[model samples]
Target: MEGQAKGLLKLINEKGIHRNTKFLAIASGKGGVGKTNFAVNLAYILANDFDKKVLLIDADMGMANVHILVNVNTKKTLKDILNGERIEDIIFTTRNFDVLPGFSGIDAINEIDDSAVYKLVQNLNDISENYDFVLIDTSAGIDNKVISFIRASSKTYVLTTPEPTAIMDAYALIKSMKKLYDYSNFKIVVNMVKNEDEGIETFERLRSSIKKFLDIDVQLAGVIPLTKNLQKTVKKKQIISEVYPSDKFVLHLKKIAASEVGEPAPEIKEGFWDRVVSFLRKEG
Candidate 1:
């Protein structure tokens, strides 16, 4: 353990090492929207498709399951570090991913103390130099801790489903952050869609509401089609990208990763989400 910690520390402290590290925070307007799945797959694709070093951080304080989703049993998490355990000690490695899993049984770290939250993110940002990208998977809700994580990140992805409640929640999350931190660097990912058209329409409706009322722009990053493979992989505790690289979900994810790392330029459309959705669906 001590040796591993030392190695991890060295990886972080070495200057000009892994110079491409970009911190991205993935959040959902509501739960069960597949934000964690997107985070895990995007990190893997960035590493495999783009061949960039990637590190996944489970920033969801009270409820973390990235390890469970990826089928790794962990003995430590980010909470252990915040509680005085060494940050390097909590680091864990999987077959294709390295992760800093969040605390266990921590349903409400927001109630813990503001200083602890500050210190946690500070330590995280400090040792982030080792990887090319640091993907933070946060919990649902726009609480203080989640907002802080979103604020500290260089970029953010706000995830949602096609449900009305989910869209409202997504809007609430974005609006709340704008009010709190004037956060504007955000993108939207419509998950679990039946097709690209559904994804685009869902993205458009939410995009229009936020723009009309909040006066903020949320980019539609892309949409993930609802796939049984994604659901099955999670049930079996494996990554779909590892099990089924040819799946359409993986393909879209690769496209998303390419855009993130500059391999492919993302298509940008301007208009209310409803119009974008209608146009894409009709074309489909």
Candidate 2:
């Protein structure tokens, strides 16, 4: 499988048919805010609805569950790649898109050294150019691992709810990250909102805080409504966009996807590989 994937990638490059892939990281400051579900559904919408190839990386290293949410069982994960397995062999392809499952319950993988982490990022960057988008579902919090992924991506989306605690934490994340890199490209997405008015209010509050304190402008991506059917879809271990195509929740997601479908990815000041290596070295 690894060889075949490589061969296909080579053919595409030879034909001059590949485009620059966009790397987007979806993260939050606290868990249970439905960040992973949003990442999975967004990937599905980009692939199935817009006919764009997408790769979803479960970057929640220790407690990854994107595979479970999508109801796909995998024998290997990012740990295997670190243990010398070909990245192509470990990638699980579904009808919608490809997934690079993350490590779960493996202490060594969870505590991977800077060198190993850099290698993993490099491998992902190598194959990323083959796809239209690479979306990473990062672990919640402002840890080194989480910040590293955000800094390396073309755009980092901070997810939060209307709750005050979640909102504060989200702001703290942006503030912390701003200290290390530019915050001009940060995007905000308010989730589990009761209505458009609620979502807009939440976004405004966060944006005002950032501008006043951090002095940076964050773009509003889109708002996801709180729908009862979303819980049912998750319980059934299915993607909302696919199972409930016409659901209001899915419709809003499609709107977000349409907004970004053909836009060129922002050019990183330093290349992806260089940025990853520089971040690791600084942390080391």
C-alpha lDDT score of every prediction, in listed order = 0.76, 0.84
Task: Report the poorest 10 consecutive residues by lDDT, candidate 2.
Answer: 103-112
The whole-model C-alpha lDDT of candidate 2 against the native structure comes to: 0.84
At residue 274, give the lDDT of candidate 1.
27
**Model 1 lDDT tens row, 1-284:** 99999988887666644365566889977988888899989988887777776778887766788888877788887777668777787887665568887775444453446576556556665567567777889999875355556765667898889899999999998898888668777889888899888999998899899989989877888888889998888888889999999998999888788788873322223211222123323323
Tens digits of per-residue lDDT, candidate 2, 1-284, equal 99999999998887545577788999888788888988999999999989998999898877889999999999899778788888999999876699999875434534678678777767876777678888989888877455667888888888999999999999988888887676456889999999999999999999999999989988899999999888998899877888789998899989889988867667666656567556656665
**How many clashing residue pairs, candidate 2?**
0
Q: At residue 70, give the lDDT of candidate 2.
A: 91
lDDT of 1 at 143: 59
TM-scores, one per candidate: 0.80, 0.88
- lDDT of candidate 1? 0.76
